[model samples]
Target: MKKKWVHIIIISVVFLYLFLPLAATFLYSIAKEWHNTILPVSYTFSAYENLYTDPRFLQAVGRTLLISGITLVLSVVTMATATFVVFMYLPKMERVLQALVMIPFAVPGVVAAVGLIKVYSSGPIILSGTIWILIGAYYVLVLPYMYQGIRNNLRTIDAKRLMEAAEVLGASKIKGFAFVIMPNMVTGILLSALLSFSILIGEFVLANFLIGGYYETIQVYLMRRLNENGHLASSIVITYFLTVAAISWMMLRLGRRFGKTEEIKEKIS
Candidate 1:
């Protein structure tokens, strides 16, 4: 009874913590005088009504999705290939390279942001404020997460045996990799993409410094509106929440796919 009560309390607190701001955002989005009050003097849908007609919010959504899609593809392919190389062929150098891959994680996001700014200050390819720079910085910030996730998935499979069997069965190296090895690693690749997608949407450190207000992601856009005391900002917050929830749903689906694969088997004639 005590343990059950503790669990209930913990869950309740977590729900409150997670949902209170969302609740407040909703309340303020429809409120007239939410300023300096325990409750609103009145409620209205005027905030959301105004937000739908705004172009900046719509543009922020488009830019956020555009950058996230690019980052997702790059991160998934890069990390999945790295996992295949390290686990299948370069076992000797895996530890050293793994350590190197984590250097970005050790460096603060602010430092990376600053370095990227100076590095791109002037070049044949000036990327400081471009969407590409944000994508690249996002890749660096979250590469470790991808590496760890895909590497774990590779560890779970009999990568060496599977690759060798496929190779010996008239499967050329590339085809074997593409069809045989890749099918097994699909879950890992999806998970890595999901993580990269999540980080890209909300990662403000690099977006704020490297790109600044010139091209803002949702977080930066909402933050800019936050200072102005407008109800449109509340709608932005809810959009951000829904975006995160979608990524979470994708990650859970990946987990279920991997888990179910173990229980199902194939027959050999």
Candidate 2:
């Protein structure tokens, strides 16, 4: 009983530590003035109102989503294909492939940005200062998450047996992958995509360095306006947190639903 109470106290303290800042930010976002007070002098939605009223803010939101979506799609398709090929055709090279995929984690963002700029600034394909550069950078940034998530999930199933079974039933390699392997991997793919989207949406270093003014993402917009308005910044952070939380919750629901469906299918089979 004493140990359980100690654990409860520790958990409570951690939750309070994590939540207090968010609570304060939410209050500040609505507070008309919080000067030298424990709470706001008054409350209003003007910060959010003003935030939405600005056309640039809307543009930033759209741009952020566009980048995130593009990165998510690119990472998912590429990693999925790569993992499938390595596991199906080139099992012996899995370690090499994993090392290659993990190269991004070893490289610092600043170094990568500089290398990209130096390479693409005056090349045949000038991607520095373009949305393409941001997309490419984001794709690399999220590769590890997508690869590991899908690869680990794939390992849980007997992928070789599944593919062979599909082949024995007279399915082509393409059909086997599309129909058999793909469906089983949907939950993992979706989870990875959500995680990638969240990471890309919150990314700032590459955005600010690679395509700052040419294409303004939410993070870029936030950085630019961070000093101008405290309430507006707080509102942006709150909105971002809410959006990420929603995606996370959706991922959880998907994992549970998929797990149950697979369990039922196993019993039926």
Candidate 3:
């Protein structure tokens, strides 16, 4: 009992450490007058109102969503297929693929952005300053997440055994992969896509460096608002937090539902 209470206390401290800043920001967003006070003397929704009234904010949000959706689709399809092929036929190549994915982690976003610009700015197929460039960069950025999540799911489902069973039943490799292996991977793929989407939405460095005002994302818009008004910036942060939280909650719910369905299928089979 004593040890349990100690653990609870530690968890409470960590929770507060993480949540207080968010709480403070939320309060600030609604605060009309908060000078030298424990709480706001008066509160108003003007910050949010102002934010909603801005056309640029909406455009930024739409562009960010577009980029995130395209990147998520591209990453999931590419990484899932590649990982499946590697695990199934090219087992020896798994180590090489893992090393390649980890390279992004070692390279900082700024350096990668600069290198990408240098290569693409004057190339025959110049992508610099285009939405395509941002999408391509985001695809690279989320590779590790997509690869690891799908790989772990494949392992958990014992993909090799499933494929072999399919083969015994006279199912070709492609058919087995499409009909059997891919369904089991849905949960992990959704989870990874959610994580990647969240990361891409919050990311400012590469978006700012590569595209900037040529194609403003939500993060870029938020940075511009930050310099203009503290309360409005706080509102942007709060809105962004709620948006991501809602998405994460929805995706996690879907993941759990998929997990349950897979379990029932396994039991039935």
Candidate 4:
């Protein structure tokens, strides 16, 4: 009983440590006149009201979503195909691929951004200060997540044996990969996509340096608002948190549904 209570206390401390800042931010967003008190003198929804009514906020959100969605699709397609080929045929190239992806992790974001700007600012095809550049950078940014997630999922499903079975059933390599391998990878793909999207949404250094106000994303907008109003900035943070949470929840539900459907199909087969 003592050990149980000790464990409960430790967990509670950890939870509070993680949650208190978010709770304070939420409180600040709603507080009308909080001054040296344990609680607010009063509360109002004006911060959220103003945020929702702001056209710039909506535009910023739209831009962020657009870029993130496009990047997610591009990363998923490219990484999935590359990982599949490496595992299925070019197994010897796996180490090379791993080293390539790890480059993003080794380099600092600021360094990467500066290098990208320097390289692309005067290239045969300049991508500086454009969404294309951001998309390209984001594609590289997500390579580690996409590659590892899909690779792990492929290993989990014993993709080699599955492909052999598909071959016995008279399916070509392409068809086997498409119909047999890809479906099993749905959960990992969704998870990696969600993680990449969340990171892209919150990322500031690359976006701020690469595009700046030319293409103001939600993070940039939030930074601009932070200097203007504390309440509004707090509201934005809360909203950002909620948006990520909602997306994560939706993706988890979709993954679960996909798993169940796959199970049913397996039982039938």
lDDT of each: 0.79, 0.86, 0.91, 0.90
Off by over 4 Å in 4: 248-269
- Candidate 3 lDDT: 0.91
Q: What 10-residue stretch in candidate 1 is worst by lDDT?
A: 260-269
Candidate 3: minimum summed lDDT over ten consecutive residues — where? 260-269
Task: List clash counts for every candidate, in order.
Answer: 1, 0, 0, 0
- For each candidate in turn, the TM-score is 0.86, 0.92, 0.89, 0.91
TM-score ranking, best first: 2, 4, 3, 1
TM-score of 2: 0.92
Order of the predicted models by lDDT, top scorer first: 3, 4, 2, 1
> CA shift at 232, candidate 4, in angstroms?
0.6
Better of 2 and 3 by lDDT: 3
Candidate 4 lDDT at 88 equals 90
What does candidate 4's lDDT look like per residue over 119-210, in tens digits? 99995989999999998998899899889988877876778888999999999999999999998888878988987887899899999999
Candidate No. with top TM-score = 2
Per-residue CA lDDT of model 1 for 57-172, tens digit only, reads: 77887888888788877878777787778888889978886897788878898988888888887978788778888888877777788888787776666667778999889898
Deviation of model 3 at 72, angstroms: 1.2
Q: Which residue pairs in model 3 clash with each other?
A: none
Predicted structure 1: lDDT: 0.79
**Tens digit per residue, CA lDDT, model 2, 151-243:** 866765566788899999999999999999898888878888887887888788888899998988889887887788899889888887898
